[model samples]
Target: MPVTTRTVEYPADGLTMVGHLALPAGADRRPAVLIGPEGPGLNDFQRRRADALAELGYVALAFDINGGRWFSDPEEMLAYVMPLLADPDRMREIGHAALDVLRAEPRTDQDRIAAIGYGTGGAIALELGRDGVDLRAIGTINAVTTGRPGEAAHIRCPVWAAVGSEDPIMPPAQREAFTAEMQEAGVDWRLVVYGGAQHAFHHPTVDHTVLPGVAYHARHAERAWHDVVGLLDECLPVVSPA
Candidate 1:
């Protein structure tokens, strides 16, 4: 399927966030998926994912919360994202701005919208859910959560989370705690752990074996992609032709 790409403007934090929107062929209004990128800003991998989602019949909006920037070093990335993550209100505003942009697109069915995020972006998605975004579903890949214990309870949409078993940052213990918290919050949530995978496994930038200290499993990455698409299908069904 062919895809169409366009730029969108979202105003927040006294700055304009420029995002990429991708739509599938035909004149149909499709369910939209708001995709949040990992760290700094949107990258090629995210843009490719947006195109892939468009091919799957969704109007995919790849959001730019970081105002179009990239940081190669881990410390530098953390330095840039930590403050934003710490301020829940700021995160919520940014998320709402992106959601607004997605919901406004003529090709998107605002009522059937969903969101998926990666890493820090994943955290933002969770915050959006906490703030009651009226979404169909939300998914996070290798995401981190910092809200209160019972915060997820109020979310009306189903939540799905995927993590790497070998990820040192989000280890088994943290994942277990997060699952327990979700259960206590009465959230309809599923947690999947990809065995032998590490943080950012889905990122194409991570090599298979060269990063000695980090583990990256390709099999898990491929499976995770399919899993995300399947989840979206379940949450945001395609409207039939009249």
Candidate 2:
């Protein structure tokens, strides 16, 4: 389907976050998705993801984290994102703000919305679910951060998380802890660890190196995207009118 793209700006975390909105070609309301950017903030990579979702007949919003800025230096990105990760409130705030933008669109069917994020953005999506948002599904890539004590219980939708086996940032212990929390909370969740892949494996090649143990795996990236689409197909499928 032909898709329309636009720039959206919203306020969150005391900064004006600029996001990219993609609308599928249709007159009827459609299921919407919230796309959170990686720790480096929103960039062309995320914008293209939104466009892909739009082409798939869904409204997608690629939200920003650093007030319309993109960070190339790993240290600089970590300097800004580390503190945000520690503060769940701030993460939820950013997620909710983006959700609001998605919901406000006339093309969006508010009842059928999903949140998917990459890296830091994935953590934000999980935070939204932990905060009890009414998302149909939550998907994360390379982010398996455990939520607050007993907070996973608030997630009312299916959770899907994917990480690379060699991702040092989300090692086996961390993945175990995250799954344990979900199991204890009784939330329906699944975790996929791609063998031989690294952190940010889903991301395409960039001009500069992001971080050690962080590289794109083309095969695993396709597989992970298939898994995410399956999750959405099951949890938030868009029905065509007869």
Model 1: how far residue 15 lies from native, Å:
2.7
Residue lDDT tens for model 2, 40-128: 99999889989988888889999999999989899999999999999999999999999999999999998999999999999999999
Residue-level lDDT of model 1, residues 17-88, one tens digit each, is: 888899998887899998999875787788889999998889998888777776666677778788988888
Give the lDDT of residue 89 in candidate 1. Answer: 87
Error of 1 at 40 (Å): 3.1
**Candidate 1: RMSD over Cα atoms?**
2.3
Question: lDDT scores for all predictions?
Answer: 0.83, 0.94
In model 1, the clashing pairs are none
